[model samples]
Target: MLSYELFFKEGLYNAEFIKKFTIDFDLLESQVEPYTPEYASMITGLSADDIVTTAREYATSSGSMIAYTLGITEHHCGVNNVFDIANLALLTGNIGKQGTGIMPLRGQNNVQGAGDMGCLPNQLAGGMSLANDEFRARYEKEWGVKLNPYPDDTQTRTFDRLEMGELKALYVIGENPLLADVHMNHTKTLFEKLDLLIVQDIFLTETAQMADVVLPARSWGEVDGTYTNTDRRIQRVRKAVEPHPNTKEDWEILCDLATLMGYPMHYHNSKEIWNEVRKLAWEIYGGITYDRLEEEYSIHYPCPDENHPGTFILHERFHKQNPDIKKSRFVPVDYTEPLELPDPEYPFMLTTGRRYESYNTHSQTRFYAAGIKVKQTEETIDIHPEDACSLGIQDGEMVQVTSRRGELLVKVKITEQVVPGLVFMSFHWSETPTNVLTLNEYDPISGTAEYKACAVAITKVS
Candidate 1:
């Protein structure tokens, strides 16, 4: 929407870059014509003039980047939202250069690493598709076992299957679904229904407490591994102190479990496991050996050979190297309203996010005394002063917040940070469990739950 406003209205786009690198320029212009500044302003509540100014600034800037978090993805139209952002970047040619490109700020330190290692159901290592015959055959040959060509169930699908009694067991690692997942009541119920629930974590989290078998895993300071940051930089981590006698390294525990089963995973240390990763996913990790990582301290991916330097900026030479190939395309995405909207009954919109002092679900942060004392001792719903005044609610007052899914008692924080008819809360407190009020609606493409937007009613507790 903003890109179209910049292109047709303000004429503030890189015509040379668009003509050389992209396709479907005419189609994109036509597709986005209807999304005027006024039209977008109506939906987003930002003034038309402000939207136009923002578009102009973004287009005219020498180098600009869009960095977003779960606020953009935790919606029913999350995938489309991302496409829209990418379209804007392509429209203004603000990508494939220094200080430019779209960046999704990962929530955790190693989320990028986990995804690169094929944590997602649909992808194999190095972002390869599971349905790709060549990729599947490579994995099968390397592992000496027949591989399932089809993609496995995602987290949302697994929950659906568990509700229907199809999935009998679950192995949770470093996650607290009871506090983190949307519709917490339903998630807890599904976990209870599971025949075997194994939770592996350093801390005995709320989810771990319910597990039939809880495997104690070593913490970050007591583990030797590589952590890939949000910028795709893989840095090695060394064990600082000895681990507890009962706890074990996450991979060692998994290897032991695998050995107990039919398959035998004869691995020694983290280096051996990393070497196996390099062997299997040569395209991305081929040159990223422990030796190189030790010598260089850190390196980004796409280092296909030992001598090849890591990729600093992606797609930098794509247009020059692959002249015949179109570099990118503008994906036209129409704006869609959130799944749930504020009504008379549920007169406010509740958006959930994280606090600086506390991390997701407060699994690790809560253990630190200094962090807890410095900021965010407990969870509180942040409401606009207008909403609080209208309801005769005071700051720090206990309130009852209810949505269709569930209700919880939380302290109130009257602030102008949030707009009228909108409230904000963090899902960092297990006691408050803000996800109890979150909706379970997910994006069809990404399967990310609608955690950012939900309808709720907040009332002062008598």
Candidate 2:
């Protein structure tokens, strides 16, 4: 906004108040290591005084739009980052507007749909808040499946159980979790322990290498479907060409699997499945149909009737009422240090992130620099100029970093963006796997790992 502080102009809220935080910034209480002004130091390398001043300006601003990608989500504090984002949005009242919202730039084409359709470990379709029973009952009635009453929200999510001899069968769809998730050694070990590993992908991915059954799947080019994008656009996509031999659409594959599993999912085609989805879906998809889509050419959901137009923006006025009003609680979140901190044994905090050159874990492509094959793909750590000079290192110098789990040799990129005693790396390569060196500990609330903070010993290798 034109105002000095964006959040204040828009009446948004921020959690930063009176706290000592950290020297580098710990966001702690006067004595507590957690939830202080030093918390600013946790995210930025500024001094405590500087952090307090900057945070005051930011938190008290009129309106602010939080922008984040894999860098925010791939860490152990990933859930906290998401929660923090939401908290900021709610606190500042920046949501329900044109210029401000917690924007999670989506990775793939259909992730939002998958999340909206309830493809997460928790919740049902339409991004229905999992704790709601009315939503659960609706799904049970629509699909005739006995729904689990409790939400399966786990921040430290792991299929590692499947590899650690805990879980049995696996039914993977388009996801290449083996390459996509952290801890390659652990993930591969988990894949090895599975009794059944079924992979369905347009191309045979690295994860598919260990699968017992590989089902050839149709690509987006050969499918007619509706994809939801980051901007909440429900756009239509038509089939452009025929899929290769023995390949079929994911809907057909799912229907077949359902039939085999003793649930008769008898759908003729993609259109048939979409029809059923629209009929049972209550909120946004109440009025959408393949017939209507064909006639109107394209339409967003929440139209409710043939005459009604699709929705573009979510926050207008009365329609944006808070449905979570029963025992709605505004939490006063105090900041906390990451679960793992660097000590004498490990003198640095090694944080892992992604690169803008390509997507996260997109390791099998030619353009990607796998294991130093390409310059952009090489493993590099972000450190401050002071820390780099103290360690007798320069930019692009090979360094050995050892964490509790494992180690990797990488080049260094010195920057002052991060606080001293903290370091960062990218988890995008297959050969130079970052997860091997990352702690598996997760947030108790979200099951997301504390990938942002891991104690490690960093030394110049050459």
lDDT of 2 at 196: 88
For each candidate in turn, the TM-score is 0.96, 0.77
Q: Report the lDDT tens digits of candidate 2 across residue range 1-462.
A: 011123333332333321111021122112222434455554555566665565456565665677777666655556666766665555445555666677788667667777777777666666666567877777788788878877653413446455456668787888777766555567777788878889998767777888999988887889888887776666678899988878998888887888998999887666666666666564677677767777776665566555567765555441244444332123334445677777899989887766666566663343534465444746678898889989999998898888877888888999897668888877776667787787766656656555667788988885
The residue pairs found clashing in candidate 1 are none
RMSD of each: 1.6, 6.6
> How well does candidate 2 match the true structure in TM-score terms?
0.77
Query: In each prediction, how many residue pairs overlap at the backbone (N, C-alpha, C within less than 3 A)?
Result: 0, 48
Residue-wise C-alpha lDDT for candidate 1, range 91-139, written one tens digit per residue = 8889888989999998888999888778999888766678989878888
Off by over 4 Å in 2: 1-43, 47-62, 70-81, 128-145, 148-166, 290-302, 315-328, 367-377, 382-385, 394-397, 413-420
Instruction: Give the per-residue Cα lDDT of candidate 1 at 304.
Output: 77
Clashes of 2: 48
